[model samples]
Target: MRRAPRIRLLLWHASAAIPVLGAAAAFYGPALERAGGAWPAPLDDVYIHFGFARAAALGHPFSWIPGNGYSSGGTSLTYPLALAPGYLLGFRGAWLGLFAALLACAALLDLCRSLRRLLEPRGGPGAASSRWVAWVAPLFVVAVPLLDWSWFSGMEVALLGAVLGRALVAVRRAELAPPARRPAEQLRAGLLAALLVATRPEAIALSAPLAVAVAHAAGSLGAAASLARASLPTALLLGAHAAANRAFTGEWSAAGAVRKLLLSNPYPTPLEKAVEVIKNLAALRVQALESALGGPWLSLVLPLLGAVAALDRRSRRVAVPLLLGAYGALLLVALNATARYQNLRYAAPSLVMLLVAAALGAHALARRGRLAAGVAAALAVAALAAPSAGFARQIDHFARASANIAGQHVEVARRLAARAPRPRRVLLGDAGAIPYLSGIPAIDGLGLGGYRGMPFARASVHGVPAVVELIERLDPAERPDVFALYPSWWGGLADVFGRRVDAVKIEDNVMCAADEKVIYEADWSALAPPGERRAGVIDEVDIADLMDERAHGYAFPSPRAGWVIGAVLPGGGDGAPRFDAGRLIPEGREQSFTVGAAAAFARGPAVLALRTDGGGPIALGVAALRDAGGEARVEVPERPAGRWSEIRVPLRDVAPGDRIRIRSLLGTFRSFHVWLLRP
Candidate 1:
C-alpha cells in the first residue's frame, strides 16, 4: 500500500514521457540526420532562438552574424541565454530538447499533485473529489501531440512551464501555511512572480492575475507590498532591457512587436473587431482547439467546468487556471483579429493550465467511486484518441515534406557560396531553416529577422507574405547577393524583376538572379520529370556580370539532339559569335568545352533568355565561366546559313577526350554552349 501512490505517479509520468518522446523523435530525427537543418520545430520562430543560441556559443552572443554585433529576431529575449550553456558545449539541440521534456514532465506532475491537494477540501463536483486526478489529468495532456510537440521544440517553452508550475504550487501551499510564516511565504511568492514576468514579456499578462490572487490570499496587510515588490523589480529589468534594445536597434521591443502592431494587439482599431471576435469565435475556436489538441475539443471543458465548480464554494482559489485560460483566450483573439493566425501554437501553451484544471476535475469524479471513475475514463479516452492518432500522422508527414524542401534550400546555399565573387548575403521569405543552413549571412525578405521596423515588415502585416514586394521596393544598395522569393508568395519572377536569370527552385522555394542572362527549364527536357523540374538552371550568357558557376564545377551532361528556337548564339557574325535571330546547333557530349588553356564547363544549355535584342525573346548559347581569355570553339556538323537553318549535329562527334581547339574569331558564332539542362 505504501508503494501504490508512488507506483501510480510513476505510471502517470511514464504515460506522459513515452508518447511525447516517441512523437518528437519521429518528427525530429530526419531533420537532425540532414546537415544544415534542425529537428523541424512546431513553429519556424523557434529557430530564431536556435540562431541566437548558435551566435551566443560563437562568442558573438545573440547576433546572427558573428563580428556584426548583437541583433535578434527571437521572440523570447532570455531564452537564448538559457540555451547558451547547452549550445556552448556543442550538444545536438535535439538531445537537449529531450532533457527539457523530462524536466517539463516532472514539473507538470508536481503541479497536478499540488492542484489535487489544494482542491481536496472542496466537496461536491470538483476535480479533487476523485483520487486519480493527479494521475489521469497528466496522462491526458501528455498523450496529446500538440503540447508535446511544442514542448520539445527548441524554445523556452518547457522552462516557462516549469517556472509557472512551481509558482502555482507555491501559491497553493502558501495559502495553507501558518500565519507566522505567511510574510516570508508571501515574499518568496513575490520573487517568483518577479521572475515570471522578467523571463518573458508575454508572461506578464499570464502571471499578473495569478500573482494578485496569491497576494490577496496572503491577506490585506502585506498584499500590496508583495505585489509591488514583484512588479517593481520586473519593471526595472524590462525597462533596462528595452532601453538597451532601443540604444542598439532603435526599437522598443527587439521581438518586433511593433511591426505587426494590429495583430499583436488584443484590440485593433475598429470597434467591430471585438464583435467579430465574439461572433466568429464560436465557429473557429472549436476547430482551432481540435487542431491544437488533436482530439475532441470538448475534453477541455472538463477542466474548465471543474475549475468553475471548485471555485463555487471558495474552498481554494483557482486563480492560476483562470489566468491561464484568460491568457489563451486573449492571445487567440489577438491572432484571430490579425492575419497572423497560425497552427494553434500560441494557444497550446495554455493547455498546461487546463491540465491542472482537469486533474482537479478528475479527482472529484473519481471520489464518487468506481462507476464515476469508469465513466470519466471512458469519456477521456474517447475525446483524446482521434487527436493523438492525427497528430502522429502530422509528425510523420511534416518530417517527409521538410526533408525535400530543406534539402533543396541547403543545396542552393552551398552552390551560391562556391560561386565566384562568392556572395555572403541571401534574402528569403522562409527565414528559418534556409538561413540556418545557407552558410551565409541571410536576411528575412519579410523583415521578420532583426530588421524589425523596416518597410518589408510593415508590408507583411496581417500574415501576408510580401517577399517580392520588399525586394522590388528595396534600394539597389540594399539588394542582397542572392534572392530566394517564392513566386507563390509574391508574384512571378519576370513580373517583379525586369528579368531574372539563373532561375533556381529548391522544393517550394524559388530563386533567381536579378541580372541573370539565361535560365534553363529543367523539365523542358527531363526523363519524364515533374513540372517541379522547371526550377531553372543558369545557362544563358549573362547580360550583366556574374562570376559564372561553370568556371567552377556545375557541369551539365550531353544531350541527344538540339533544335533551333526563335534565336541562337553568334547571330551570323563570323568576326564574333553573334547569336542571330534564327540559328541552330547540335547537342554535344558531356557539357564541357576544351579551350586553349584549362577546360571550362557550362552548367546547362541556355534554354531561355531574360531579355531579347529585338522586341521578342532571344536565345543565347549557355554562358561559360573561365580563367578568362579562352579561344572559343564553334562546332556544328555543317555550318548552315544564318536564317531558317535546319541544324542537326550527331552526339558521336563531341565524344569524351575529343578536344575541340577553340579559337575566338571576332565574328565567329559558337554552337549551343551546353548540352544537358541540369546542374
Candidate 2:
C-alpha cells in the first residue's frame, strides 16, 4: 500500500471538533429551549456536582453545606473541584452548566485526537493506509447517541472518557517509542492514569492496560520501580481523598458508594448478597448488549472484533488483557444495583473501553487482505448507522428529561428559597437541587449528601421506624424544619410525622422518581408520651417511640418474620394518632420485651397493664419474675377487634430487669403500649 498523505494535527482536530460539538449543540439547543431558556441538567445528579463545586469555590471543599463538616457523598472528588473555577467566575444557574458543556466538549475533542493516534499505522508492508481510520473513528464516536447525550449532560462521563482515551494513546506511543525517550512517555501515561482513577474509582480496572504498558516500557528500570514512579501521583491523590473522608465521616470510601452499592446494603446473610451479585452480573451483561447498544445485534460486533484482535500476533498482549480488564470493570459495576440506571451511565465507561479495543481489532483486520478489510468496513458501517438512527429520539428524551427536572426540582427549590424565616434544615430524598438552589442545610434522607452514611444506609433498609430513630436522636437545632420528598419514596414516614404543606407536580415525568414531590412541616409532638396516665402506673413503655423501645430493650424477628410496626387513627379522621408502633405477632407466636425504670422498682407486687388490639385468648408471662419460681402466666378473654383494650396480669417480685413474654395464643394481634403499675 502506498503511504497516505499526512494532515496537519490542527486540521485533524477541527474535523473531529465539527461533528462532536455539532451533536452536543443539537442536543443542548432543544433541551435549553424546553427548559424555558434555562440550562436544566439532563439528570438531578448534575446539580450535585454543581453544589459541591460552589462549596469548593467558597473555600469549603468537601462541605455539602457551608459551615457543615466534610461529607464524602460525592463519587468524584476531582470533577467538582475542576468545576469550581466556573463558580468562582460567577457562573450561577445556566452559565455553570454552559461551563461544564465547554469542558466536556474539549474533553471529547481531545479523546478523538487520541483515538486517531491509536489507529494510525506504524511503518510495515501492506499495512493498509489508516488515513480512513482518522476521519471514520471520530465520526463513529460522535454518531453514538449515548456518548453525545453524556457529553452535554453536564456530568463527568465525557471527562472520564477523554482521560482514559488519552491514557491509552500515551501508552501505545510509549510502547513503540525509541528506548531513550520511552521513560518520559511512560510517565506521561502514568499521570493520566492517576487522573482517570480520580475521576471515577471503577476506572481502575479500565486503567489496568495502561499500568501494564507503563511497567513494561522499553529501556525502563525494573517493573516495580517503573510502576511506582508512574503510580505515585495516583496514590497520593487517592490517599488524601480517603484520609479526608476518614477524618470527617470516620469512613474510608465515599458516602455515595457506601449507600448506593448493593454489597454495602444490609443483607440478611453473605449468601443472599452472593445471590444478588450473580443475578446482577447476568442482568447487566444482557442490558449492556440488548438495551444500551443502538441495535441489539450490534452487541455481537464487539466480541467478534475482540476475538480477531486477540488472535493477531502483534496486538495479542494488549488485546487479551484489555478485553479481560474491561470485563472486570463490568463485573465490579455489577456490585452496584444501579449499573444500568440513568441510561447505563455506570456501565458506559466499560462499554466504551470495549469499543476502543474493538476499534483496534478493526484496524488489525484492515491491515490484512481485501476480504478482511471489506468485513471490517461492513461491520463498522452497520454499527455507526444504528446509533445515528437513534440520535433524534435520544435528543428528544434528553430535552424532556431536562424539562422535567427544571419544572419539578428547580421550581420546588425556588419556592423553598423564597419562604420567610427560611427553613433551618430541609430533609430530602433527592438531595441534589434542593440544598444547592435553596441555600438551606439539607439532611439527605437517602444518605448521599449531608447525612452520616452507614447508619442512614442501614436504617433505610430496615424501613421508616429505623430512620425515625436516627432522626429523633439528632440535636434539636439540627432537626429538619421541612421535608421535601417523593411521597412514594418514604414509606409512611411522612404521613406519620409530618403535616403536608405543599406539593409540586409535573407532567410526562421520566427523570424524577415521581410525578409529584410533596413538602411537609416536621411534626413530632404526636410522638411524645401521652398526657393521661393510667391509675397506679409506675413505669410506661411507649412502643410507638422507637427510641423508647430501644431503651426498654425491644427485640423482634425480621419485618418478614411476621413483626412490623402498626398504627391506627379512628375513622381515619384528624384526631390523635393512636400510637401502636411495635411487633404485630401472628396467631400462636410469642414475643418478649424488657421494661426498665429510672428509679428503683418498688418493693411490692405489680400488675402488667398491656394495651393491645383485642383478639382471642392471650397468655402473658414473666420470665423468672421471682428467683424461686418458674415463669408466671395469666390468661385473658377476647374482646372486639376495632377498639384498643387493656389486659392486666398480676405479678410478684418482678423487677425492671426481668423480661415479660406475651403470647397471642389464639388470634393474630398487635402489642402497642405496656405499663407496670403498683397493685
Candidate 3:
C-alpha cells in the first residue's frame, strides 16, 4: 500500500479550485468597480466581520468598535480570528477570504475523490475511467450562485466547507485504520470537530454524530483514547472562550447570541422552527430535482444513493452522506430557529454534500451499460452546466443589487469621513460598512454591531424589532456624536434626540451632527413623550413621537401605517408622508379634505406653522372670522409637489379681537403637525 504522489494530490486539489477563483476575480472585480468599488460581499454584515477582525487584531475581542465594551455581535469566532490577520496585514478581506475559499475548495475536491474511491474501489469495473464525481462535482458546486457567493463573501461558509470536509475525511480514516493507527485518526477527528464547534457553534450537532460514528467504528479502546485526546484540548479551548466572554462582557455566550436568539429574535419556540426547517428540506429536495439535471437524473441518482446509504455498510462515502443528513437537519433547525433564511448560505454545506453524492451516483450509473453510461454523461453535463444557468442569473442579480446597497453604505461612510470635524461616534441601524470605511467607532442602533442592553425587546413577528422607549435607556456615554435615522421624519428618533442638535438631510436620511464639546449640556431636557399612535395611524399631534420611535418595519410603528382615499393628490417620502383624502376617491382627480378646528382664542400676536409637501396650495388655509358672511381665504401661497415646505404665516395684521377659523389642509399626508403660537 503506497501513498499517492504528493504532486499529483496537489494538482488534483489545485485543478478543482483555481478555475473557480479565476472566474470570481474576473466577474466581481469589474462588477465591484462598476459599483464604485464596493466590497464584494452581498451583505453589509460581511463588513461587520472586517470591522471586528480589525478590532480583535488591535487587542479587542469581537468588537465592531474597538475601545468600546466588547460586543458579542460576531456570530462565528473562528472566521474573525482567521480574518483578523488580513486586517492587520493591511489588505482587503476579499483576498484573504478567497485564499481560505481556495483551500476549502481543495478540501472539497479531496472529499469528492474519497467519495469516488469509496463507491468504486480501484479493483472495480471502469476504475481507470475519469471519476466524474472527483472532476465534475466541484464545477457544479462552484457554479451554484449562492454557494459561489457564500464562499467568496468573506464569511464562514467556505471555512465550514473546509472544516467539515476535514472532519468527514478524518472520521472515515479513523474507522478504516488498524487499531494502532486508529487512536491518532480519532484524535484528529476530535480536534477537527472541536474546531468546527469553535468555528460555528451550530456545528455541534454535526460533530456529535461524527464523533459517535468514529468512536463506534474504532472500538472501545480507540474510542476512549479519541475522547480523551479530543475532550481535553476542546474543553480547554472552550473554557478559555467562555472565560474571554465572561472577562469582557460578563457572560459565557456571546452577546450576539442573545441579540440573535432572544432579543430581536423572531421564532417563538424551537418546535415551530423545527417545522420550518423540515419544510425547507422538502423544498430543497424539490429544488434539486427541478434543477437542470431534471427529473430523470434525480430519479436515477437519488434512489441509487438512498439504497447505497441504507444497504452498503462497508462504503465510507455513505458515512459522510449520512452525517450530512444529520448536520443539515440540525443546522437548518438552528438557523431557521434564529429566523435566518433556510435556503441560503446557512445550509449551503448540506447542499454541496448532496451535490457530491449526486455526482458520485451519476458517475457510478455510467459504469452499468453503454446506454446507462451515455445517459449518465449527458445528465452530468446538464447538471454541471445547465441548472447553473438559473444560479448564474441569480448571481448576476445579486451582484447588481449588492453593489447598489452595499455601495451606498461604503460611500456614505466615506463621505462622512471626508467632512470637516469628523464624527468619532455615530449611530444608525445600517452600521456595518461605516466603521470599516470611516475608521470611527459606531453604536449600532440595530444591535448588530454589538451593544449591551440595547433599548428594545424581541417582537412576535420574525425579523421585527421592538419599539425603543427613550434616550435615558441609552447610556449617555454611548450616545453618539452623530445620530442618523432612515425615513427621517419617523417620530421615534426625533422624540429621542429632539431639538438637542441640528439634523440635516443626506441621501434620504436624517443625519444629526452634534457639537464636538459637550455633545449635550447638563441642561439637557427630559425625554419628550411619544406621539399618540393607535391602530397604525399617528396623527399630527404626536407625529414627532412616530418620527423618533425605533420600531421594526412591522407592527404599529412599521411601514404598514398608511391609507388611500380618492385622489386628493397624496405625497410622501422616506419620512412620514401626509395625505389629504378627498370626500371620496376618484380615479384621477385632485381633491382636498377639510379639517375642522374645535375652538378659537382671541388672536393678538400669533403664528401658524405647518409642514406640507406643498404639492397643492391650501395645505393649511386659515382665515379670520368676525361676523363673516363670506368665507375668508388667506390666498395661501403655491408650492411644488415633492419637497417639504414650511408654511409659517404671521398674524401681526389681524385685529386683536378677531377670532380665526381653521380651514382645510392638503397634500399626500403621512405626517402633518400644525403648531399655533401666541405671544
Candidate 4:
C-alpha cells in the first residue's frame, strides 16, 4: 500500500514534468530554428547572466568581465552562481541557455508538486476535492504560457517561483507541527527566506509573510523563538551582500537598481517623485490585471474567497500568509518601472503568487458542493489553462526575438572578435550580448556591466553631455579603442568624437534599440584646445570639460544637487559646454574659479577674459585671499543672442590666490571658456 501511494505520487510529478518540459522544448525549438540552428536566447539580458556565470566558473565570482573586477550588474546574485556549475560542465555559449531552460523546467515541476500538496485537504466534504486538485492544480500552474515564457527567457523568475513554493510548503508544515517540531520547520522556512532574497531582493516581501504565518500557528514564546532562529540566516546573507556591494560599487543596492529605478533618477521635488511613483503604480496594477499571462482579474479577490476555509483555524494560518504575500509581490513589481518591460519578466513572481492564492480559493469552493466544485474547477482552469490560449503566439514571438538578437548583437561581436589584431577595448551601449560573445573587455556606456564608479551612473541619468564629461575625466589609457552603438542613441557623441569604421543595419528591427548600429574608431583630437594659445594668457580653464573645471579648482553645489551639464551646444561649429535647468534645478547658477599665482602676478593687473554666449548679464566678483573685506565687482552686459562673444572683468592688485566668482544675474548664460590674461 505504501509503495502504491509512492508510485502514484511519482506518476503525478511525471505528468506535470512532461507538459512543463515539453512546453519549454517547444519554446526553445522555434527559437533555435529561427536563429538558423544557432544557440540564441530571446533577450540580450540573458547573456548578462551567462557572462557573469562564465566569470564565476573561471573563479572570478561577481566580476562582469574577467579582468574588470567585481560588478553589481547581476540582479540575482545567486542565479549566476547557480549557472556557474553548468559552465564547468562545458555548457558554454548558447548551450548555457539550454542549461538554464532545463533548470527552470525542473523548478516549475517542483512548484507544481508543492501547489498540489498545499491545495489537497485531509478530510470532510473537501476530501473529494483533494483527488481532483492533485491533477488540476499541478496542471494549472504548469500550463500558463507566460510562466513558460519567463522560464525559457533564461532568467531567474522560475527559481524565484520555486523558492516561493517551497517557502509556502514550509509555512504549512510549521502551521500543522506541534511546538517541538516547529523549530525545525521554522529553520527550513528561514533558510528558504535567505534563498528567496538571494534570488531576487524584492522576494523579501514573500518571505516575510512565511514568518508571520509560522508565528500565528504557535504562541508568542514559540513564535518569538522560532522567528529569532529564522532571522539569523537572512540577516547574515544580507549583511554579506551589502558589504560586497559597498566595497565594490560604493552602493548598498545593485547597479541595476541604480540605473533602472525611477526613484533613482533625478527629480525636481519630493512631491513630483511621489506623484510619479503613484502614477506608475496605478498603470502597473492595471497592466498586471489585464495581461492574459498574469491570470484572470479575479485573482485580486481570490484570497478573500479562500478566507472561507479559515473556519478551520489551521486553514486560516495558510490563507492569511498566501493572501498577504500575493499582494506584497504585486506591490514589489508595481513600484518598479522596468517590471512591465521585457515581456513582463519582472512581474512573473507576482503572477505566480496570485495563482497560488487562487488555487487555494478554488479548493475552498470545491469543498462546498458538487455545483460549487464544478464552478471552482472552471475558474481554476481559466486562471491557469486559459493562458495557454496564446502559447502559440508567444512561441512565435520568442523565435523572432531570439533571431533578432543573434543577427544583430551576436554578429557584430563575432566580427569584432575575428579582427586581425583584436581591438584593445570596445565601448558598447547594449552591453549584454556583445561583451559575452566577443570575449573583449568592454566599457558599458550604460554602466550595466563592468564600467566602474557612481559618476558613470549619475552621468548616464543626465544624458550624453554628462556622460561625455565623465568620459573626459577618464585617463587616456582607460578610453575605449572602438565604440559600438546605435546612431539613434548616441548620434551627438559619436559624430563629435568618432570616425565611422563600419555599420550594420537590420530589417524589421524589433528587440534592438535601433535598426542600425555603427562602429567607430575613437578620435578625440577635436577635444583639444581649438587654436594656438593667445598672447598674455597665463592660465585658462575649459569650463565645459568637467575635468578641466576640476583642475582649475572650480566649485559649484548645483550639479550634485540635480543641475546637469546642458546639451552639446554647437556654437559656430564648436562643441561648447553650458548649463541648463535640467530636470529639477533652476536655470540661475553660480561658479567659482581660482586664479593661479602665475596669472595673479603677470605683466600687470589681470583681466578675466570669458568666451561666452550672450544669454543675459552676469556679475563678476573678485577678492584676494586673506583680504575678504576688499572686493571688486564688474557687470557684463548681454551681447548678440546667437553668437559667441568675449567679456572682460578688469581687476587691480589681484595677487596670487585671488578668486573669481561668476553669477548669472538675469537669465541662463553659457561660458565656453574662462581665461586669466595679463593686460
Candidate 5:
C-alpha cells in the first residue's frame, strides 16, 4: 500500500535521529547533573561555570557569589546564551545538557554535508563510482584523531565545523553559478565566514582561505567587495569584544595579553624573544598532536595522508584552507602550548579543513577499491580504540573519586554553618560549598577581587597583616570566624596571622586552622562548663586559660637527633629500619644505624618511659600503641619550643606495668635508643 512507503520513510527518519538522541543523552545525562555537584577544588572550573550561570539566572550577571569567584580574564558568553533557554524551561541541568546536544547535532550534520560533497561525481562520473568513494570518505572524516578529542568536552568545535562546511558549500556553488548572481553568492559566503569568526576568534585564520577561495571562484574584484561587506557583522562582534576588554581592564586586547606580559621575561632582543616564542609554540603543537593521535606516529601519518589527498585536482581548492588552518593551529600551539588547556576544543575550528582534506583523499583512493577500504578500516579502528581507551581510563578514576571529594567538601561546609552563628563572615582560602551551603560569604586567598578582600581586611583590623590589602576598614568583632588554610598556603599564613592556634584535619591533607586571638563562640563554649555561659562576660584570661588547659600536646612531632622511617627491609627480606644521612642511596640498598635514648619525655604521671628519636614535630603527642595497656594515647601537656630537638621526660611519669615502645613516624631511623625509666 502507499501508506507502507510513507511509514517506511518515517521509520527511516526516526532511525537516523536515534544516534543524535543517544549521543545527547550520553553527553548530558549524568555528566551535567554532576557538573556542579562537587565543591571548590582544583579542576572544579565546571562547577564555577555552573555557579556563574546560576548567578546570571538570578539577575546578577557578572557577579560571583561566595564559593564561586569572578571570571578572571576571558569569559565565555556563549555558554550562558546556549544555556539560557534550558534554564528558563525549569531544567537547570538542561543548560549544559542542551548545549552539548546542540554541539553533537552540529557535528553530525557537518559530517553528512562533507560526505555529500565528496560523493558528488566530477566530469560526468557515474553515481555508482561516487557512492563507492563517498562511503569511505565519511569513515575517514569521522575517524580523525582530532574528532575523537572533541568528545572529551562539549565545546564550540562542532558548531565551527558546521559553519565551515556551509561556507565551503557556498564557495563551490558560487564557482558554478552565473556571473550576474555571483555577487549575491559571494555575499552569502562572506556572511557565513563572519558567523564563524563570531563563534570563535581562532576562526579568523580559517577566514583567510575562505576569502581567497570566494574571490577566485567569483572571477571578479567587484564581486569580492560585495562578499567582504557580508563579513562586516563578524568584524563588528570581534571589535565589540575588544572594546569591552579595553573598557574593563584598560587594555586593548583580552586579559591574555596581560598574562603573556606577566609570564614572559624581558629579553635582550626582539629576535631572541620571537625565537623563544616559536620554541614554546612548537612544544605545544607536539603535545596537541600527541593528545589527538595517542602518539607521534598517528599524528604524522594522518596529516600526511590529508596533505596528499588535498593535492588531487578535485580536492585542491578545499584542501588549501584545511592546510592553512592546520598550519595556523600548529603555529598557535607552538607559541602558546599552555593555551592547549582546552585540548582539541582549542584546535577544533581548523578541523573542518582537515576533514574536507581527508574526505577528498578518501574519494581519490576509492578508485583503487580494496586499498581504500583497508585504509578506512585501519583509520576507523585507530580512532575508536584510542578514544575508547582514554575515556575508559578517565571514567575509572574521576567518576567515583570526584564525587566523594565533592561530597566531603559539602559536608564540611554544612558542619561549619551549623556551628557558626547566623550572618557571621567565614574566611576560607579555597572557596567551595561554604558560601552556598553554609549561607556565608566566601573569599579566595589568591586575591582576584571578591568577598575575599573583606575577610583579609577584617583580619588586618585585629592587627593581622595580609598579602593584598584590598579593603581599608574592618570591625574587630566582624573578623573572620574561621580560617580555611590549605597546606600550600599554610607557611604563607605565618607571616599574615603571626601564628597557627588550632588545627583540624580535612581531605587531601587539607588543614583548617585558626588564629588563637580570633576566637569563635562555638569553639569557646565547647571547652567551657556544661551550664550556659555569656560570651561577652568571658575575659581574655578566661578564654586563654581555657585554651591552654584544653590544648593537646603538639599535633605533630619534630625530628631532631634521628630521622623518621617506614617500610625498610634488609637485603635478605628481613624487616629493618633505614636511616637518612644527608645523601641519596640507590634503590634497595641496605644500611643500619643507632640513635641514643637520652631525651625522651612523658606528659602525665607514669612509672615507665621509653626513649627514641625518630618522630618529627608531630609525634610529640601521645600515639596509640598495640602492646600498651590503654586504648587511648596520651600527648605531652606542654608545647615544645625551638623545633622540638628532643623529647624529655621525668622517670616517674611512666607506669610500672605498662609496656612502652617508641618508633619514628616519618623519617629514616634504622635503630632506636631503647630505655625504661623508673621512679
Candidate 6:
C-alpha cells in the first residue's frame, strides 16, 4: 500500500465514518446541552467512566472505593476503559465525543482494509474494482442497524471492530506467507491478537479462532508458544485487575462475578443456566443475521452467500476465524442474554467478524469483472445505506429522549442541592447520575439500615430490637436531607417515611422527591401517649395478625381490563384495613365487587368508609355482611353489579370496630380500602 493510496484510504475511512459521527452527535450532543448536570441511562456508565477518568487525569488511582471520593466500584469497567484515553488527552466531553467518532472511523477503516485484502487476491481487472469493493464494504458494515445503535451507546464497538479487523489482517498475512518467513509474521499476529484480547474480555472468545489460526500457521508446537506469547499481555492486565478487585471486594473474581450479577445471575440450576445461555445466543444470531441480510430476507441471503463463498479452499482460513468469533459471540450472548444493555456491548466483537465475512463475500463476487463488481457493489451499498437510514431515525429519537431525561435530571439535582444543608448525607433512591450532578454525598438505598446479617436471618437474632438498634445507630445528621426515589422504589421509601412528612414531587409517575429535613409540627402534648414519637406503617402493623387476616381477590372484567384487591388486618382487636393494588384507581366513581357466596370475607365484623381520591372525605353506605362461623360470608350486591358504585358499611352494622375488605368488580375506586376501627 503506497502512501498516497493510504492517505486516500484514511480520507475514505473518514468520509465513511462521518455519517455515524453526525448521527452520534445528533443523538448525544443535545444530551450534553439538556443534561443540566445529569447524565442519561446508558450514559450512567459514561458518567462513571468520566468520574474515574477525571480522577485518573488528576493523578489518582482508578479504583471503585467510594470513601476515596472518586470511586467507580459500583460501575462496570467498560466506561473507564473507553474514556481513559480521552481523559489522558485533556479532553472533557469533547474528547469523549471525538473518541467515539474515532473508534467508529477505525472500524470503517478496518472494514475497508479487510475488503481490499480479500478482493485484491482474485487478480481483478484494475484498481477501480478493488477501490469500489474497499469503499463499499465499510459502507455496508456501517449500514447494519446493530452497529449503528452500538455507536449511539457509550460502548467500544468501534474499537472492538478495529481490533478484530487488525487481528484478521495479521492472521491472513501470516497464513499466506512462506513457511520459512512465518515465525516473525506469527509474532506480529500474536501482538495484534493480544490487543484484541485487551480490548474486551469476550474478545478472547471472539479472537479464539484467530489464535488457533496463528497457532496452525506456526505449526502445533510453535502455535502453542505463539498463543501463550500473544495472550501474555492480556493475562497480565486481567491478573492485575483481578488482584485489585480481590483487595477491594474480598473476591478474586469479583469483576466477573459483579458482571454476572449485573448482567444475569447464572448460579441457579444447570437447566436454568442453559436456558438463559440459549436465549442470548438466539438473540445474537437473529441480530447478526438481520444486519447482514440488509433487513430480514437480505440479512439471510448475504450471509448464506458469504457462507457459500467461504466453502472454497482459499476462503476456509478466513472462514474459520469468522466462525470462531461468531460462535464465541453466541456463547457470550447465551451467558448474557437477559441483559439487553450488556448484550449490545458484548455483540461488538461478533459483529466485527460478520462484517469481515460479508466483505469477503462481496470481494469474491466483485472478482467476476466490472459488471459483476458493479452489481455486487450496488447490492452491498444498498444493504449498508438502508440500515444507516434507520439508524439515523433511532439517533433522532434517542437524542430527543436523552435531552429530555438529562434536563429533568439537572432540575432534580439543582432542586435537591438547593433544599439540602451543607455536609448532609443524601439518601438517594437512585444514587446514579444524581450524586455526580448534585455534588453531594449520597448513601445507597440498597444498603439502607446496614446489612442486618442476611435478609432471611434478620428476625431470628435480634427481631424488632435489631431494627430499633439500627434506627438508633443511624445518625439523623448523617441521614440524607433530601431523599430522591425513582418511581420504581418510591413505595419502599414511603413505607419508611410516613405520610405527613413525605411529599411527592411528581412530574413522571411515582418519581418522588421528599425532604427528609422537614419536621412536622404535631400536637404531641395532646396525644394518648404524650411525647412519644410517631411510628411508621411497619411499626403500626402487628405483622402476625396482619398476615393471619390477609385476603386476596382478583377479578378480570375483560381480557385487558382486570382488577386485583388485597386486604390485610393486624391481629388483636381490629387493625386498620389495608388494600394493595397494581395501580391506583381515581375517586368519585361507582365501584362494584364480586363476593363469592362460599368465600369468606373479613375475619371479624367491620365498619367501612369509602375514602376520596386523596383520602379527604368519606362516603357512607351499606353491604350485606354475614358471620359464617369464623368464616364471614359477603354477598355481591345487585344494585352496584357490573359497574362502578360506592358502598361503605359502618363497623356497628357488621363486626363492631373491625376492618372490612371491599374492591371494585367493575369501574374505578379511590386508592384506599375500607378502614373500620375505633375512632
What lDDT would each prediction earn against the true structure? 0.46, 0.72, 0.51, 0.69, 0.43, 0.47
For candidate 2, lDDT tens digit of each residue in 1-679? Answer: 2333444666777788888878988999899888976785888899889988998999988766676567787777778998999988878865689889988988888778778887777768536643466667777567567666776798898888788788877777667778777778778877888888888888777566667756765454568866775677677778998887777665676777767777665434567777777887777777665455555677677667777777886565456656876788888888886765676667667766766777777877877867778888787776667556667878998999999888888888988998887899988874588788888888877666755433454345445565565575566666788999987878667887788999899999877888999989987654423345656677777554545665677665443343445555342123455545555666656666676766367556787777777567766544533545665666667767666677777776677677766666555556667788888
Tens-place lDDT digits, model 5, residues 257-373: 333331222212456557766766555556555555556665555565567566765566666777787667555534442454433345554555665665655555444456565
Q: Which candidate do you rate higher for lDDT, 2 or 6?
A: 2
For candidate 4, the per-residue lDDT at 394 reads 80
- What is the C-alpha lDDT profile of model 6 across 1-679, one tens digit per residue? 4899779868766766665455555555655564444333334344444555555555654542133332324333444556667767755542454555555555556655655566555443534564566655556555565555565555556666666677777777787768777766776777777677555666667555676766765653476776764555556666876786545433454333333432323124557667766766666666555643356666654555457347645666676678667767657555653334432546656666766776676666666668877776766765555455455545554454444434444455556556634435555432344555566665544421112111111211112221222222334444344555543333423233323333334232211232222211111111112122222211111111111112222221221222222222222122333222222333222222323223334444343433322222333223433433332222333342222233444333343222233434333443323333322
Q: Highest TM-score: give the candidate number.
A: 4
Tell me model 2's lDDT, rounded to 2 decimals: 0.72
The residue-by-residue lDDT of candidate 4 on 1-679, one tens digit each, is 7999899888887878777777878888888887866686878888988999999999998887887777877888889988999889989887888788878887888888788878766687757754676676666665556656777788898888788788888878876777778788888878887898889887777677767766766664466777766666778888998888777766777777776776776533556656666775665565554555444554334444455544445456666666666567667665565665676667667667766766677777787778888887777766665556668878887888888888888888888888767887887874578878888888777766756543455456556666665565556676788889987777557877788988877776666777677888886543433334567777877654544554567655353343444333334334454321122122355667776654445334677777766455656554544444455665767676655567787766455566666665544545557777777
Candidate 3: tens digits of C-alpha lDDT, residues 1-679: 2456677667766776665656566446655654555455556567777777777888977767776556666767777777777667766543443444444455445554554344444446654453544555457556555556666655676676667666666767787788788888878978987887777666666666666667578675656656676455456667887887667554566555545543224323546545665665555454443442344454344334434343434443434544465445444434443334412545555555555555555655655556666776776665556455555555565465456444466556666676567775776663466677777677665555655534221211212112232223455554565654443322334333423343232232211121111121121123222333223221122222221222211112212222211111233332343322111111222212111232244434456555544444443345544434433334456677655555665545334334444444443333333444553
* lDDT for predicted candidate 3 compared with the true structure: 0.51
Model 1 Cα lDDT, one tens digit per residue, 557-600: 21221111223323322333332211122323223333212323
Q: At residue 407, give the lDDT of candidate 1.
A: 50
Model 2 worst lDDT run, 10 consecutive residues: 566-575
| TM-score head-to-head 1 vs 5, winner | 1
Name the candidate that leads on lDDT.
2
**Stretches of candidate 3 exceeding 4 Å from the true structure:** 1-14, 92-126, 129-132, 220-253, 261-311, 314-343, 360-379, 452-477, 487-491, 498-679
How high is each candidate's TM-score?
0.60, 0.79, 0.63, 0.83, 0.55, 0.60
TM-score for candidate 6, residues paired by index: 0.60
- Estimate the lDDT of model 6: 0.47
